[model samples]
Target: MDILQILILAIVQGAAELLPVSSSAHVIVAEKLMGLDPTAPAMTLLLVMLHTGTMFAVIAYFWRNWVETYFKSPHERRTNLIGIVTATVATGIVGLTLQYLIKHIVANGDPHFEIEQLFGNSKLMAAALAAGGVLIILSSRIKERSGVELSLKSSTLIGAVQGLCLPFRGFSRSGATISTGLVLGVSRRRAEEFSFALAVVLTPAVVAKELYRLVKHQGIAPGASFPSLIHMAAPGLLGMVFSFIAGLAALRWLSSWLESGKWYLFGGYCLVASLIVLWVN
Candidate 1:
């Protein structure tokens, strides 16, 4: 990819990743329009780097608040840890189960079938986007309830919803989790905080998975030379920097809209985006 394409992809990834608008969907559409293969190893590597950038953005934006809220007291810290652990475990279980089913059953027991193969399916992406959009819209319309904390039930539900997002490109993880929290009567701010915390916890595993796939596909065995890995990663480093900057801006935008009771606008945009994807494909 050229510098211009990288810039566009970085910007799209950064903006859509945090805005509950499904960054993967937008990035895939952009790649398609640019005549690029979204499933290529190089492209996937860049995409993973972009996600790493956003993951850092999440940590940067939420660190102070996390310290204040979860670290204020020992009891609070323990409670928060329990919630995070529970949610993460649920996410893993559900996500892995879905992945197994997709790979084995949907792919007709093809051992080599990778879930990334579905990433380029525009029709499937449209449906996932539409599902996420509807959930966001419905959650936004619900009356804001007070005094609800991140309990086990709420966290489990949120994580399960997030897991469903894992195999589907256009299913927004942040959107679905936050909406699930809202629908379960959790406060908006609390839901957003928990949602992003889950993201931070989930990102490292995803990044490692992508790196493994990239290295394996490049025919690099375990204990490969460092130079080869660096050469492969070099093209995506600049994209990561660009995406980091854009991701911070997008997070600010998301927070503002969410606080201003304009969250439903993102849902509207997603609904329109789903149609656009369907039309384009």
Candidate 2:
């Protein structure tokens, strides 16, 4: 890919990754439009950098807020920690179960089958995107009640929604989890905080998996020069800088829309994006 393509993807990944709209969908769409294969080794390396950039952005943006919210008191911290754990457990159960079903039933027990096999299916991605849009729209319409604290049940439901997002590439994890929180009467601020907290926990695992998968795909010998690996990953550093900047900006935009009750606009955008994905394919 050229410098222009890298810049485009960086902006897209940075902005969309933190937004309620699906970042993966946006990135894939941009890559497809540029005739780039996401699974290609170079692209895989780029993706890792992009994810790393966004993860850093999340920490930078949310650190202060998390400190105030989660670390205000020992008891409060413990309670919130338990909620996080519960949600994570729920996400693991649902995500793993879906993968198992897809591998066994959909793939006819093929040991080599990965859920990624269906990722390139345009129809499925569009359907998932459309479904997510509807969910976001409906959740946005529900009046947010202030002082409505998040409960374990609500957190569990949100986690389950996150799990559901795992296999569907176009379904936004932040979108689904935040929407579930709203549906359960969580305030916009709390929902946003919790959703991102879950993200911080889940992202490391995803990054590791992507790294392992891409390394295997690259088929590099154990004795390969470290600089050679760095060189391959270097094209993405510029993207990382852009993605990080974009993530901070996107988070502000997302907070504005969500706080101002304009979140339905994201859903509207997702619906249009879904159509575009289907149409282009």
Candidate 3:
């Protein structure tokens, strides 16, 4: 990708990565609009790099709260740390298990990434978008009914949604997890905090897996000759920096909007956008 493309992708990555909209869906759509093949191994690597950038943004933005909540009291810290770890492990297990089941069993050992294939599959995308949108809209509507706070069960449920999200692009991990949290009785602010914390920890491992795949494939030769990793690096890094700043800003806006319980707005957007994707594709 050229610098201009990188910038466009970076902004989209930054905004959508944290937004209730599916970042992967937006990115894949952008790639298609640019006439780029989403299945290219080199492109996969670049995509992971973009995720890495946003991961940093999550960590940087949430550092103080994480440190305070997770590292201040010895006992409380240990407990919260274990809770986070437990939830993360649960998410990983679900994600990896689903990935294996699909790759080894359902796909008959095919190594294809599901998102790359299904993203442009308008029917599937529409279904997932509609399903996720319904769930999010319903969850937002129910948040006030059950006024309970967050706990381990809610966290695990959110993490499980995150895990399930790994195999599907339009599913929107954050959207699902946050919705899961809300439906399970977690407050909006706490749900956002936990959702992002889980993302911060999980993104690196996901990136590493994609990177290893890229290296094994060797030489970026797909629809177009692969750009040098070095060339890709600059854009990825620049994307990360830009994303971090944008994420900080988005966080502020999200906090207030989240309190207003306007999550259904995003659901409506997804529903409409899904239709648009169907029409375009």
- TM-scores, one per candidate: 0.95, 0.97, 0.87
For 136-240, candidate 1 gives per-residue lDDT tens digits of 999899888888777888888888888999999999999999889889989888888899999999999999999898778874557868997797677689888
Residue 92's lDDT within candidate 3 is 85
Off by over 4 Å in 2: none
Query: 1 or 3, which is superior by lDDT?
Result: 1
Q: Name the TM-score of candidate 3.
A: 0.87
Where in model 3 is the C-alpha error above 4 Å? 109-120, 144-149, 220-229
> What does candidate 3's lDDT look like per residue over 223-268, in tens digits?
4434555665665676666766766666666666778878888888
Ranking by lDDT: 2, 1, 3
Candidate 2: RMSD to truth: 1.0
Top candidate by TM-score: 2
How do the candidates rank by TM-score, highest first? Answer: 2, 1, 3
Query: Using lDDT as the measure, which candidate wins?
Result: 2
Evaluated against the true structure, the overall lDDT of model 1 is 0.89
Clash pairs, model 3 backbone:
none
- lDDT preference between candidates 1 and 2, better one: 2
Please give the lDDT score at residue 33 for candidate 2.
86
